[model samples]
Target: MTFSIVGRCPETGQLGIAISSSSIAVGARCPWARAGVGVVATQNVTLPALGPQVLDLLEHDQLEPAAAVERALNANGWSEYRQVTTIDAQGRTAFFTGKEALGVHHALAGEQCVAAGNMLASIEVTAAMVHAFENAAGLLADRLLAAMHAATDAGGEAGPVHSAALKIVGDHTWPIADLRVDWADEDPIGQLDTLWQAYRPQMQDYLTRALNPTLAPSYGVPGDE
Candidate 1:
């Protein structure tokens, strides 16, 4: 029981995914992205392997999102139980909600994004997510957060969502942001947003430290002096 958005920033060429679910640790199982490649969200009886398989096709096989999704589905006998959405580096997108996907499922493909949901309060949840992502301002992460908020406002999962995740990949192999709330009785999206606000300022610093420790600023921890 999950809803998610996988999108590319046209201006920055960054790729990211924001997702939430009634299940725990949705991040570890659902969203996947590769820098300069694409993003994928696999849910509804999620086959975790499909996320990486789709990315490999996009990155090395020169396959577009639609073709890659088709290939991945064909390789799995349980495809009919899975729901997947993908967006390529060029903004081409594709999605599928298997016939066996849970209640009130829908998938929407937008300009540079694709959203999917299963066991949802309503089909409009996916549509709301895409609309918010397309119109929201600020950084890609903020836009993604806005989309999640819209999904929740539109009706969210059929049941209470206990977990949420936000992930973004930029030019480097490592992710620029990877935040998750494995489980929360309250608002997981709000928790994720708070983590993003705290992490945003230090994002570039972390990258700088990795690339050039000497040029990076002080750690700012108690014992750094």
Candidate 2:
């Protein structure tokens, strides 16, 4: 029901996740990331809490991606229906697709990324995403969009996808870029891309405000104008 990419940008050392699903509000339900820690995408039958639990193991327990994923799965009784992918800061990665997953499910890893999908129209979609993310140019967000486009180009999920999300963690506890399309009948992924583009220019300003308001730029909204 979902396809996602969890990646560590080799150039920036940033971690993020780009995900889409046929289900509603996949943004709030699937992706999770921690600054200087790791990223997780938990889908398929979809246990939302598993995302944070995996990150907890990575951040607090100081476990690597594989160990953290294994521990999280072992602790849960519902592993058989979940497909979760995890990637740590060091480019270490691991994935699990339970026996109860949908149509065509698979996970593939790249130099600093992992792509996974369940109920996919084609198994090659995940591979295509990894290739796109690895070979694409520009910022981490752009590369994530490229990988998402690759998945759709290769025939994404078995059904029409309705929601999408992109979450990137930098130096703060909050995401540097958290963009989501909770649901869209037409094109959620495209909506996500557009939202990211609109936010890109203001991203730095917001971060500056968070770290040092005196140096941050003006709001440029109605009141400021």
Candidate 3:
């Protein structure tokens, strides 16, 4: 029902996440990230608490992503239907899909990321997402978007994508950019890509201003200025 990317921006040294789902308001349910801490995507039978708790544990010096995931799962009151992925500050990653998770499919972890998507037509979607995240060389946001695009190309959620979101935390906890269409006529992933491109410049300006407001104001088309 959902596809998401959770990762660290290699260039900006920022932690971020992006997600889309056929379900409404996927933003409210799918992605979570904390700069200088970690990222988590708790989907399928989602667990809301895993979002904050994983970052909490990582901030406490819990560097082993697998251990952090295990502890989080253990504490989850609803584990049977949950699917979770956690990436710590060190880029260590881990994932878990419960027995009762939709379609019963799970995923594996690699160097800096983990991925899981249930109710997918094939395992290739999840595999391709993780591969893109691991192999792509660029900013974390680009890499994360690539992972999501790969999954969409690989057949996506075995259904439609209705809602999408991107969350990045840096020196500031507030999202540099966040948008959720909630519903779209078609090609929601493509719509998300368009929104990302349209928003990137403004987001960059916001971050720059936050870091040092003395920098020149964002220059764009005369109308936008």
**Which has the greatest lDDT?**
1
**Candidate 2 lDDT, tens digit per residue, 164-198?**
99999987888999999998997899999999999
lDDT, model 1: 0.93
Native-to-model Cα distance after best TM-score fit, residue 33 in candidate 1, in Å? 0.4
lDDT for position 27 in model 1: 94
lDDT of each: 0.93, 0.92, 0.77
Off-target runs (Cα >4 Å) in candidate 1 are 222-225
If scored against the real structure, what TM-score would every candidate get?
0.98, 0.97, 0.87
Error of 1 at 65 (Å): 0.7
* Model 3 score (lDDT): 0.77
TM-score computed on alpha carbons, candidate 2: 0.97
C-alpha RMSD for every candidate: 1.0, 1.1, 2.8
lDDT of 3 by residue, 1-225 (tens): 876767775556677777887788888877888767888998887777888877787778554777777788788767878888877666777787888878636575655667778888688887898888888876677777888888888888887788887777776777676766678868777787788878876877777777897884857758544
Kindly list the per-residue Cα lDDT of model 1 for residues 151-194, writing each as its tens digit. 99999998899999999999999999999999999899999999
